[model samples]
Target: MEMKERQQLQYEHDLRNHFDILSLSRLDRLKHYGLHFAKYAGRLARGDAEAKSRNETLVDAFLVALSAANALNQKLQNAEVDTEDAPSDLAFTDHAGRFADACEKIDHLEEFRSIALDANAAITDWIVRNATVRGVDLDALVDERRKQLAQRAVYAPGS
Candidate 1:
């Protein structure tokens, strides 16, 4: 079945509820969001360095971006619904360093709250655009990922 486009906040809520993040304290929940963001941000930096647009990594980065928004209690609704494939932007250049730098600042996020949110949102856009450029189905991929996440052994079933 085809999945419809959803807001970034919907993704965040799905993740939180699916993973029982709602049960944790505010600080721990922030940590949870931050950890996922950091993990994918690092991976994205590496992938960008090689100029490889791995579909899975792109989705992961998108999810991480959502998590970053969640950590800051910000409404992130920048998902590009029904995006169509097009040529890669000619202006595309190495953004690995900037992404890595964003990850670093977000790691110590309290001091750079606003920018961290912006960086994460930017990461989300980059991932979507890159995936589209590579002729990938990001919505389908993310829907599959959401299913996998829901069934993962780590989380109790049927949360």
Candidate 2:
């Protein structure tokens, strides 16, 4: 076999042996969590905090989801999954564009924070509602996460 073929075979072998299928499964679960975090950040951004904090959290959540999806895409690429055969490959491209758009919004937060907050909340609320037909109770989730963080701080070794 050629060197490239040999390397491909080795990569496949290593992936099969070292990969945990559960990680791939978890990636799917993370999609919803990421969207939730984005929506939550949008809601918070409408408040008095600095623009950087608000934009950062929204961008961070989006990047995390994009990163997870990219990892899975890398595995599929290694397996030689034909792009034409996988509609998800096209979806991934669409997601990459969304990620880029989020980054661009972050770049302009200082000048447009208030406007961005309202727009972000509107767009994210629609997305959240579409994702979960009943819609998310943002206040409840925010309260729960805050409590969890406070509990962690109290039990932290340094404190």
Off by over 4 Å in 2: 1-99, 102-119, 127-132, 154-159
Cα RMSD (angstroms) for every candidate in the order listed? 6.0, 18.9
Give per-residue lDDT, candidate 2, residue 100. 40
Per-residue lDDT tens digits of candidate 2, residues 10-110?
A: 33532443244224554343333345444544545454554544333333333333233333332211122223331222333343335344435544553
Report, for all candidates in order, the number of backbone clashes.
Answer: 0, 0
Alpha carbon deviation, residue 68, candidate 1 (Å): 2.0
**lDDT of all predictions, in order shown?**
0.56, 0.37
TM-score of each: 0.59, 0.26
Model 2, position 90: C-alpha lDDT score: 30
Per-residue error (Å), model 2, residue 145: 1.6
Question: Cα miss at 5, model 2 (Å)?
Answer: 59
Q: How well does model 2 score by local distance difference test? A: 0.37
Most lDDT-accurate candidate: 1
